[model samples]
Target: MNLTPNRKEHREMSTIVSRVRAAYARIEAVARPEIWIDLRPQAEVESEARAIADRVTAGEQLPLAGRLFAAKGNIDVHGLPTTAGCPSYAYEPEADAPVVARLRAAGAIVLGSTNLDQFATGLVGTRSPYGAVRNAHDPARISGGSSAGSAVAVALGIVDFALGTDTAGSGRVPAAFNGIVGLKPTRGLVPTAGVVPACASIDCVTVFARTLPEAEQALSFMASPSARDLPPLPQRAPGPWRIAVPPRDQLGELDEGWAEAYEAAVEQLRSAGAEIRTLDLTPFTEAAAMLYQGAFVAERYTAVGSFVDKAIADGAADLDATVTGIITRARDLPAHQLYTDQDHLTALRTQALSELADADALLLPTTPGHPTLAEVAADPLGANARLGRFTNSTNLFDLAAVAVPSGKVNGLPFGVMLIGPTFTDDRLARIARDLEPSVQLAVVGAHLTGQPLNPQLLSLGARLDRTTTTAPVYRLHALATTPPKPGLVHVGEGGAEIETEVWRLPAEGLGRLLAALPRPMTLGSVQLADGTSIPGFLCEPAALENAEDITTYGGWRPYLGS
Candidate 1:
């Protein structure tokens, strides 16, 4: 279930259709129907993939070429019926939602549609009538919703990436539970014209991917030039940010494991050079409650109240009771109260801005804890509310968030969310990247893309950042090892621009990576052509005395003509 990036396969191993076939096979092998509400027929998926491949063959520059993805059933996919987690409310769309169209145009092929908390109403995936989307790591745990299925699809590797629409934390919570990256971009940055509304005014189309760069690639392609973005999303410079976090006492109650994970993430950031500031998120918390507890709950009603009303009158409603209760309660809710709540919301939003006025982003746990399906079943509302302890206010307060895996809690995946001011998506992402627990590794030999040792990187939670050369400053040697490994030695003269790949992995795994290396090889920093230094495999001078200097070949994979 590790969704690590395999640069080798992506760059050279398979055709787009073949990849689609493998994905279909993977889906069938998993045989988990609850993960999806409706899977596009395998034939149709392949057909679309072939078309994409043909376009690429014709010289189209498709950044997402052959990338497989799925959509939250609520987002329209041309031929699929938009269900928004309510099967009874399904409607076929004549064209793609702007987001989906953008992805397709970039060469991504849709595999199917995923389930969600019906009507995108709940944070716990259990609210879905399609069957609760199970956690990718543990079937018994909740998958965190209302974008449950989209997160699962990516976590399960059924697709390279997937789309989810977030109103509250639907895009982020599920990612926390599944141990992947979820980006809930600035609202309206991507068109929501063809999506089923959850809380329309605040809803956003979110992306879930195994890595940050992968998600960034998709985001860049989907940003609409004409979006009347309120805050005017500026492409800000990535920063050495001042991150805000709730005071320890204000973090609310969380399991020891999760609490520890949260602290570790903050410490990691501190170690990485970010200034951590303690703050009270009372205003942000209040804004979050306003979405449901206050009159903003009326927004949900305004969206689907009529349909639910008619269904109730006809005795044909099959919606979850919780969803029914919340939406219906707002039907006869006083207009004056709604208006009054809006006024209060303005104050809360303003307070929210002041709370972190000097900070670049707010770093917090993605959720308080992971709840099991049974626990959620016993106290659905309470459990669901707790799940959003750190997420509910983002949209209402006009903030942007990116949830990234922190580590684990009780052997289950745990994560932290980095939120920034509206339109500071780039800045927030910069902070998240800085927060990523990774060591930049330069591999030149068996570990280069498609080489024998490439799997080692993928197994270490590593993803290829890019491939370049070592600026004629390193000599490559064919080391004497059973697997014929290569060793790189920094040379001051007569060196060549040896090709290398910069791989990124969790910094914590550096020890394991070193232990797995052959006796003569060591991990050391190597300088790239751009002058950036990165940890790379190095050679013992003694070991290289009898080794073959294969510097002429540039890199090991090519030395083998691979």
Candidate 2:
């Protein structure tokens, strides 16, 4: 019944597939037929499994090797009807969305397309004609959407991850409801070549995974730019990072339990050595308001107006009344008004970006609070808007974000989002990886506390060693490398008390750090103070030819400082 699978369990390939099939069977047994308008047949699923098995047997290097995932119906999958949860608007897509194609190429098997708020319109899952996707933690509560089914699938362990779109918190709100990781990469970072547009300029292809590492892996494989995609944004290096959190007063009527959960999460980050500070999010809030209140709604109308008008004319669309009203209003907005709103949005984006000048990431609740399905249904538009209070601003400001499960409140899941400036997807992922407790690694080098690279370590979510040390007989060398590197060398005997520190890094950051490391230094097993060996940095003996033997100084910082 456990949805989250740990790779460390070393479950056999057949067993993993069996678990997935069993989960699907259980889903069928529950008979929530309305959750999805179309479910892939067992024969099709089995065929996909066989294909995956053949690939694995051929020894292919599949990034998502043997993993199962799903995509929101709005995103195309060849041969499948992409209804976007409105049966009347359904059509067969000739090709997969670029994002889905990348995932499949990386060894991920698609189970089937999931339901969504029709045309990816509503933040609440209830707008779908297919059925309201219930919150995973509490069926009575609403599953924040339009990525509703994608989040529920991962939360229920139906897949390793799911692809969703975020125009206004669509990617993140469902993650909060399901207690999963929702990553909204920078706009245009993941191509939208085949995705049905919600807001073409601001739409982001997003991922929902059970863990931060899983989400990051999916992001790495899917973040490539293509001819149809936008150009890559420049990368930013880490530094002494400043993280901003929303002021307590700005949370806006969060129930007592959610308020307590947010505070506890902030404390946890503080304990992890993050410089948590409060900043006014008013500018960001104002930008979010523009998404709906300003002429931005006209953009959504522009994307789907022709099709919607045809459907309405034919009386074939089962559009939600609220959506119909909103779209109709968009039809009446003046061109000049749209231009004015665009200028206003540009100004707000400028102001929001300026606020992040001193901060590497901004942290906030994924949503103000969780609302029940009944609550949302009774006053659908109002409840849906409230759920988007914290999320609507993200796309408007063109920010990258990762929503991490911060733990539960009153049996309902709560999440915290790490927001960074555009194209800093990798940086935000690194920080989120550190915040997650599941990924564990050992570090030895300038990354250790009091060392030259310690700031980088802290920015990536590293914890300093307090009661750790290196093996007694190892020699430490100070490598002649920029940013002042250190080398830990193992020796036979009579070695000095070479001071060192140990740290645990998340797998994503570890990969990035390893990739960026200069020649001569690499990650390998190092004997710890207690005779145990964990993955740490060591240098090739050849590098020592020009390196300084600073074993006497005990580690890199003191040696480099002198």
Candidate 3:
């Protein structure tokens, strides 16, 4: 993100205040007020970070030292109001929520409070008094919330990580749409004290970040002991991963043919050596239905019914209609119906757990697909329901999940969630790390990791996959762009094996990289000596007419010695 020009160094030794300032600079650069509900004054934020940095001088080590984060409005930030996206319900919190406090103790700076679905009730990020959070990648699309602002903040690089509460799929859905990592810990793994609840018993505070390591870094600091916690499982237990894939007929429809994209995610993991087993998703899907259609919805009312009642008395117009409807329905559930539903949930939870008995984790599309703001507005409740099709059951069944960016389809971000049994958070996190998708691009000149345009790749969250040489069929040429660049041209015969570093970039990043490329250079498939062909840089043959042939350098890195 270029937030810290000295990132590699500062992340290791910089003072928290300095890093915090850099983070604020990135926020200022974007200037997105709509993405934030309340920002701590820069001076106040720096002061807090500075105090934390002093501990390093005193010889204390902090795992998340110098990291910056945004908290969903529902999560109390000491000096900010906890609105849970309802202004009328806002209340100044005397202290940070225990989870937020823990993060601060680890040296993470809170940039501000972010927007969410009113009372954290909807999946579409639009049901809030604050402006709808525009999709980080596409302004016209829904951000996929309840945890909307938290997801968008991380996606935009405004924060290194963010706190989001997930009840249903609020946390994971937005991560999928925004193309980032979303870790929805098993319920109670992170303390919820001082945080507003959605469905109190099942709600989980989640962490959203650009990478799995970053999310895990934050997760470590927020952990709390709970009576229901299961003993930790082996992190990504080795060997062929027994991943349970839902049968194709059970996936239903996905937007823009994303059903195929979801399958592609399964195959990608398979390529990495995971064993896939398809199974019936009916029980899981039915349990998901009980959430809003059955009596369990009463949990939401029990958590916030009083607040809604007060709001209605003050003026119902101030409350979101959809939220009002959901809460009101919960308040009216007959005691007998509620008991019967609870029994049903118990049966379904048992069934859901049985399905995971032989698998490392359950894989599902994070959301059907991204919806335009218009599409959501036209069918507010229905649209939100569809977004939760695959997600609603996780909390109901007491599972852990981490959503990893899978790929893009029809110009939208698509992702899959790795859901494992409760307390399998570590295992799910590790599997997510293994499954994060990236495109292996062989870079020649300016795009090489340390070169001038490398920031473009880093900005897209690219990482160096490996360095290698091309097959003995390509020659290198120095393009005459102002900054000077290299073009790798494949000639059928009499060519050198060009040295190149293949970078693993977010698949959706190709488009952004292409938009910034200078003429005569374009992305095309290039084969390496290993006989692997992946998307890489290429030059228009005509441009080579006037270009300097630098094949002797073998690659761009050595040519730069000039």
Best TM-score goes to which candidate? 1
- Which 10-residue span in candidate 2 carries the lowest summed lDDT? 1-10
Model 3 residue 8 CA deviation (Å) reads 15
Q: How many pairs collide in each candidate, listed in order?
A: 1, 0, 0
Task: Residues 87-158, candidate 3: write the lDDT tens digits.
Answer: 888899999999999988887788899988889998989987788888999999989899999999899877
Q: Candidate 2 overall Cα lDDT vs. reference?
A: 0.77
Q: lDDT tens digits, residues 1-562, model 1?
A: 2222454334322478788998889888977788898888988877777677666655678878888899999889898898888878889999999889988888888888999998999998888778988999999999999988889888887887899988889999999999999999988888888889988999999999887766777888878755863645445356666889888888889977877889899998898898888878898777777777878788888789999988888886568888998899977778899889888988988887888877888999999899999999999888888887789999988788999998887889889999998787887877787666687898888787787788767655577889899977888888767567888888878888898899888674566588657678888889999988988888888898878888888788778774
CA RMSD of each candidate after superposition: 7.5, 10.3, 7.2
Off by over 4 Å in 2: 1-20, 225-239, 437-562
Point out where model 3 deviates above 4 Å. 1-18, 225-239, 439-562
CA lDDT, candidate 2, residue 113: 87
Candidate 3, which ten residues in sequence have the lowest lDDT sum? 1-10
| Candidate 2 or 1, higher TM-score | 1
Reference-based lDDT, each prediction: 0.84, 0.77, 0.84
Candidate that beats the other on TM-score, 2 or 3, i.e. the better one: 3
All candidates: TM-score: 0.81, 0.76, 0.78
